[model samples]
Target: KLRERLKISGDYHECNETNSSLLLLTENNTSLDLNISRDAVFGNCLDLAVKKFQKRHGLVVDGVVGGGTQRALNMTIEEKIDKVQLNIDRIKWLPREKNERYVIVNVPEFMLHYVEDGEIKQQLAVIVGDRKHPTPIFSENISYIVLNPYWKVPEGIVRREVIPAMVKNPNYLKKQGLEAHQTWDENSPRVDTSWIYWEEYLYGQKKFPYRLMQPPGPKNALGKIKFKFPNKFSVYLHDTPTKHLFKKRVRAFSHGCVRLSQPTDFLKTISTFNPKINMKKATKRLKGKRKQFIKVKNQLRIHLVYLTVGINKEGQVEFRNDIYNYDKYQKRRIR
Candidate 1:
């Protein structure tokens, strides 16, 4: 009960009750070979074991039992059992996949697996939505790939961010690589800003009737390309301008859409599946800043899923924090 008395603060060669509990917890894992002293010391062996344990559990391998690491260590057996049972029940609820080629994006895991001929052909890291704007779970076929796609800023974003920014500076649109069109159509001529009182919209006296569109380029929110799977929620997989986020251990930051870490690599993989795709031309178009939409002749399905427990590379069972707290409502049931 040393670990029960207190969580390990973390350091090498420290002899304390916390270290004793930490060692006990690490010893129980059995997956890693600590081989260090079990004599209530946070020795080098225990540090190595802690790193391995953190790596195995998808925690940041800092060798320190920080808040995140402590949370993982503190997970009760009953809670883990509930998660396993919930996932077991969840499997039955999933509609059987009919396609031989499909993509599965497990929301909680923040990972995408491309399966072909019953084998996992490719896997890609992805950044999904946080609790506020949780990613929706649904299945849809990706019909086309849009290169240098324009981002039609959502109405909510326009209302909250764009409108407020524009109220202060009318030139905000031009500065952000955005254009205010008279209509939703791209070809619609740019409206004269001076004529309309932009402040009326800020005051909620008049409905903001202009559509904002960001042109295809490096500044595009959708990045260089996007895999489209049309749905009511308008959610799809796409590249992001901020590529650095993928480096972090925890990557649940997006506005409901799934962000791809290796979008170009995934695109190349897709190119192999469809012979009609011209990778050379796609690359050229990207560099030339010319937008192109390529049709995917081969059928491809994208399933956005919710799972908190999954197997790691070594076939070891791993648990993920339910950031969305979906486990609370997803009561396990059997028919």
Candidate 2:
């Protein structure tokens, strides 16, 4: 009965009516030796039993039994039934269909996957947000991509980081390629660089009377390409000039935006599968000085997701480091 409920097919290796009956008996943590005589049901073919058990539960398929495989096999029929059922439910939580292609960002594992025709074509390590600044999960269409975009300093960033730094050294903004702008109305307090020494303002001893913005260049925080999507959060995926940062296995060093290790490779991959546009020309265009904006020929769906447990190509369930603590939230939701 457990075998039927598990949907274990007769086509599986070493499976039979007799073993099927044993499955029901041993399904609830009951132990049975493979050496049992052929006359006995659910006995013999220990190797085949282990392999089948592993295959069904998304474990490494080694005929030789191990602790993990043993633990899984020993699970009661109800427990085994629930494991499969839960994964099925999890699958439902994912996007079922897409318009031919999409980019998938699994936040928990800190990886990005490109999927086409319901199969993962390419995967790359990604730096997600830390616990304090966890990456948000959402789906959006990639409308257009910007090349060498300018970094617009947000208000919070100016007040928290820039203003204090400027007070210490008048040349701080100059070294960082920042320019000051004064545009407040008459009612607003005036800030005069001539009166308030920049050195004092950098140390928080005085306040600078201006807005600062760093221009676009190699030193600019945003390296090159930036994928644009309409969202309230004003967040977008982009390349970073600090390419060395991607070398680290756990790259969670960003203010808020998602940073890619190999953004050029990603762009090539996305453009290749896209029905319109020549990927070769696009690659060539990036070399030019002029910034380019290419609208996706066919709107591609991009899903920013999080999953601590996932299956690999070998069908083995792999666990990744939970950088964002999303697993606890998911587990709680499931419970």
lDDT of the candidates, in the order given: 0.79, 0.63
lDDT of 1 by residue, 150-169 (tens): 89988878887888888899
Pick out the ten consecutive residues of candidate 2 with the lowest summed lDDT.
Answer: 28-37
Find the 10 residues in a row with the least total lDDT in model 1.
8-17
Error of 2 at 299 (Å): 1.8
User: What would the C-alpha RMSD of candidate 1 be, to one decimal place?
Assistant: 3.4
- Model 1 clash pairs? 3-21
Writing each residue's lDDT as its tens digit, candidate 2 over 146-216 gives: 77665667666766687777666666666776555564322234344435454455444555456655445
In terms of TM-score, the best-performing candidate is 1
Model 1, position 24: C-alpha lDDT score: 55
Each prediction's number of clashing residue pairs: 1, 9
lDDT of 1 at 314: 75
lDDT, model 1, position 165:
87
